[model samples]
Target: MNPGASQEPAQPTPGKHARHPKAGSISQPLLFAASTYALGQVANFLFQLRLLYLLGPSQYGETGLAHLLLVTLIFLADLGYSSLFLRESGNSPDWQHTWRYALGHRLAATTVLLAASALGWQLWGSEGASQEYLLWAAPACLLALFNYSSPMIAEGRRLAGLLVTQVAWPAALLFWYLLQDSLAQSMAATAGLSVSLGYLVQALVNVFCSRQLKLWLPLVGKGQIGAAVHLSLIGICGTLHDRLTPFLLAPLAPTFLPFFLILNHVLSGLSGIQAQLARLLLPTANTAPGQARILTVASLLLWGTATVLLAGLLIKDLALFTGQRPWLGLAAIVIFAWGISASSGVLATLLISARLEGRLMRLLVIGMTDSALLQIGAAWAGDAGYLLWARMAGVLAILVWQLKLLKLRFGLAGLTTLALSLLACVADATDWAMTIGTVLLLPILIGLLRQAPCYLPARRAGAHP
Candidate 1:
């Protein structure tokens, strides 16, 4: 750890709904984490570019499906409990107890995953050499418990340990990938190895950092464990919120998998900006609602704009980038774009701050059910864009219902999101007039954002909240 590096802490606010100024609370450790996460993201994005060049479409589709399954399995392995560590870690000063519990839980998870993998192998590993590779991924997933705790450790800016995991693990994978000659195993194997190795380093680093920081998890009763499990359950829903897209596309069309995956990646990458801002803002929302709202709205607007720009600029070449049959249908892309933009991660984090985390997952379950139904319906319809429409419709329903649940009284501002969703659809079908109408209306809508407490103001010198 860099002992000389300045480290600042984020104190949990005293008030129920207020927070200290976020700009100051967003200390070096958090900044480093946010930057590293983004860099790792971009690197993975570049890695996908390489994957497209090498894997082409069909295999890309297969790879995407496999990845989705892995993610889903990871979800199952954790039983939605890792996030408890994150939230709890943020408030707890010493993490000796937290580490003890986390280590115990992770070990249990790892054991279960190992047994399940063994059983799965006996039952179906012989499906194909390709599938055997999938079965082989179990060990890596089991070992990935380390990364799960990185967020927890980074809560107070003790980020050096997490940094080692983030930086060193990928480097290790890149080295091994170059050394490996088998093209077939390169992508999947490298990913599995990278994640496991990375998390291993991360876990080790967390141990050292916790020791150096003199942090210890507080000893707690079974009741705390239960509460942690409850929050972690809701938090797992947040993870699945991003993890299930490829699974939806898998049975629909193998060729469309990579294309849809690319679209999902773009949507996710853009939304991550929102999530990053949310992390910075949520801790402060308890002290400075107005300020946090400013930051939130700005984040939403930036991501929303980038989403539009990416659509206008890359819609044509997006398929070419995938090397697979570019699943055509700008309308589908529009639906996807608008859906993601409308459901910003900032909003999700805000919900968490509001103690509405369960509802977020509750809403997500509804959307997932709707998405799944749409998947089934699309399969029956034998169409290309049906899933897109399904997603659009389901997400719109979710937004509308969530809006109602949130009791958002921003009459016109809420309508603006709906109107934008419609305009994205209009842009899809060459309805330029409608699209432009929405675009022209954007500024007026932007102004209305001030009415909502979702955005926060930028910090200035000598700022105090």
Candidate 2:
């Protein structure tokens, strides 16, 4: 008998589970996931704060550029295999084969990435701080094997292990920052070491917890490479848009790079919570589109409102954190961008679960291209604020494109949300504008609150009716 085959009772069909492995309500896991994700974000925020203060502007910018390159390479190495694994593992009996194949492919890809990095470094030679940072950071690519793979494994099992694995790296960084203040080692080296340690911890925990699953990696698995490649291509444009933007901007506007990096990080972190929640809600989207739609819309409204409120509350703290004056317009833009991202994420998940990857690929390509062109034009203008607004336009385009693909007709509520966000942008630009915008937002917020309970899990028939 194959070692990967289990003797225990057969698992229920993937989408057939009446209730999520957690409590019946999908909100439970989402809440837990969000909590863990938020904790991780906190740790990450601290780590970035420390690093920025330690390295100062020029060195921090270089580190940020290196970090971006490493992340891009790692994402390329994973090649969307993890997402494919998560989606397929639930239903496929031969999931072990799938895992093995993906693992093999990932290993090969990582090898190629390392080689490419080394080759580029050798050919281009060292340029400056960024190149020096890359030299130290390149070794961390080895950690990507665990970095990319472990989360997927946890996610595939629909376990909280993802939270654990996700938080490990930031925790490691915080630990390092507290214990070691020595400038003896390069900042990049310290960061790489911390991240590598974190990934190792994550890998170990994931493997141990998933032991009962009897996971195995064969030398190669039939058809796995081709399938992963196909899925990966669907994500390429979006990935490039995200990872390449920093690289493009670093050279074009070096002084703004550090601030842009911080702004981007904060915005992405804020948006990440929504993205994670959207991911948690994805299984439901597959099994119950109606419930998922309600939840998605509700989440968008709740978070959108929260974003505006929180930005207002934290404006001072944000300025202090970045050591710069807070730009209300930029803050508003970030909020709107996240709203678009959160909504698009849920919609994208639904489409992906529906096996509409081809459509998604086309949408991504067009949206990313449009966004890139706008960003380039913005960069040429040499204003960081304009660059951010350009990004907002891109996110909005993608959101609109996603709506079209999902065939979700924009309702009055949806139109209101968009209008309010745009108005918030105007408000951010002027003090008087904000006061008027706040008055307009009152009714929208009240209406959303009134509709919130309807999106919650319904009470049992006898219990409620």
Candidate 1 lDDT over residue span 1-465, tens digit each = 231232222222112222443432334545555555565556556655555666677666655555455545655555444444545544556455555565556556567766774575456433432354365455556555544344544465534433443543455347446645754555556554554554455556655654444333322333245444545555455455445445555666666667667776555555554445445555544444533453334334533543453254334344554443234444345444444444544445445555555566667776656766765677567655675566556555665565445433223333554465455444544535334544555564454343322322223356332
TM per candidate comes to 0.70, 0.78
lDDT of 1 at 418: 49
Candidate models: Cα lDDT each: 0.49, 0.60
Ten residues in sequence with the least summed lDDT for candidate 2: 9-18
lDDT accuracy of residue 378 in candidate 2? 91
1-465 in candidate 2: lDDT tens per residue? 232222321111212222342222346655675556666666666766777887898888867766666667877888777666555544457766666666677778888988887687567454555565566556556554553333454355444644654655575675577546765666656665665566566666656655633453434655466556666876667667766567666676677678777877776666556656555555565555434443444445444654474345334334354544355455566566656765666557666656666667778888888899998899789776677778879977887667555544455556666766676666554546535655665676665554432122212345220
| Model number with the top TM-score | 2
What TM-score does candidate 2 get on C-alpha atoms? 0.78
